[model samples]
Target: MNDDLKAAVLERCRRMEIPLVGVASTDRWEHPPFLPWMPEEFYPQSIFPEARSVIVVGLPIHLPVLETSPSIYYHELYKTVNTLLDQYTYRLASFLTDCGYPSVFVPRDGYGSIEVLRKNPVAFFSHRHAAYLAGLGTFGVNNTLLTPEYGPRVRFGSVFSAAALPPDPVLAEDLCTRCMLCVEACPAGALDERDYPEGLTDKAACAANSAELARRHISPCGICIRVCPVGEDRERYGRTTAAGDDDPRRRRAREHVRKYGGL
Candidate 1:
């Protein structure tokens, strides 16, 4: 029965043009040994006590134009993708509810209110990591999800469901070979050379720089995503497609770029 449900969900996702999807027990994220930035109240168990499963979905962000003008396009693309994810999650929750299962849409605001952040400074856990553990994709050094087909060009969203769907087995693809390309590409030096248990990110620095960029109404840096070898390959495929070239991969890539700008 679980397998049949998984098949149905995957087919729906494919039809929706969502390239990556998975399921993970909500218990995993709600475990006691919490990581930094993971506020206890943010856990599924805390927010949706009855949620038994989470359906994670990943949409590729393969927009090459954003990379070209990082200060102008990245934020725009991110906002678009984030909005799309919100709508998608809401729709999925409605679908599950119609099917006689309880569902909820996890709020996307990572930065808590000033009062909440003061109480819990590290309130934004590695959401991308959580998405990966949910079997949606693999983690890259840049702290982004690297999908099998789209590398780090993806955004993740999930639906918390009361139904007990069998969890998707975690993926073992360690695509980040520690090449340090992402670290090198980070203009803000937000990536550390040493890998910490929580991953190698200078979250404070990244956030500060991003905030500053937001103030200026410019796109934040996407050098890490742009310089990634896998990202480059995806970009190549996208251009080919947009130009009406012979390669179907290129055509698909082009369409993605036209829609999202860049990752």
Candidate 2:
């Protein structure tokens, strides 16, 4: 019964244009074997109580669009993607409930504001960690999940369910180059590349910088995502897509530079 239901969910997700899907048992959380367990408040069990498994979904953000980070172009795309993810997760949860499997959707944008993060850097759930457990990717130096297909250019959301779905194997490979580009690229100097999976970020500093960028009406800096070299091979495929030649994003970026004398 669980296998059939899992298959149905994956089919539905595929029909909805979801590119990546994986499931993980909640048991992966541990101190020594895996990364330390998240605090009880942030666990899937905390949200769904009966969440035996998590269904992690990935939505790819166009690499070209992300390359325009800290610009209105990328900012708008970010918001749009978040909105879509929220709606998608909600619908998936509804689908599971209708099938008699209780489920809950963990939203994409967990932090309401930098102020909220300052109060408690943790959220009720973490989609990235869920993705990692689901074998979609592993942690990179920048703390972003670097997927094999898209690197850090993907956003994730998860649905926690009572169904005891068979778990996906966790990815064992490290995808990051450890080039320290993400550390150097961070405008806020919020990262140190000395550690791969450990907490190497100054979340407070990162949040403060983003908040200040908001005040200036500038798109918050995502230099780490902008300069990541993991998915550069996608450029070969991007160039092959003839339809992207006259990309409006490219046109807008060129105009911005020409008029403002800035990149």
Best-matching candidate per lDDT? 2
TM accuracy, model 1: 0.77
Give the TM-scores of the predictions, in the order they appear: 0.77, 0.87
Best by the TM-score measure: 2
Cα lDDT tens digits for candidate 2, 1-263 = 28888899899998899988999887665322444456767777767788888999988877666655566666677778888888888899899989888898888867787678777776677898889889998888898888888778888999988888888888898898887778887888889867654756898888888777666554557678666777643675463331233567765763563343123
Model 1: weakest 10-residue lDDT segment is 236-245
lDDT of each: 0.65, 0.76
What ranges in model 1 sit over 4 Å off?
Answer: 30-40, 112-126, 196-199, 231-263
Candidate 2 matches the true fold with a TM-score of 0.87
Q: How do the residues 108-200 of candidate 1 rate in per-residue lDDT, one tens digit apiece? A: 555544344334445443457557667766667677776666667677887888878888777776676577777886878888665433565
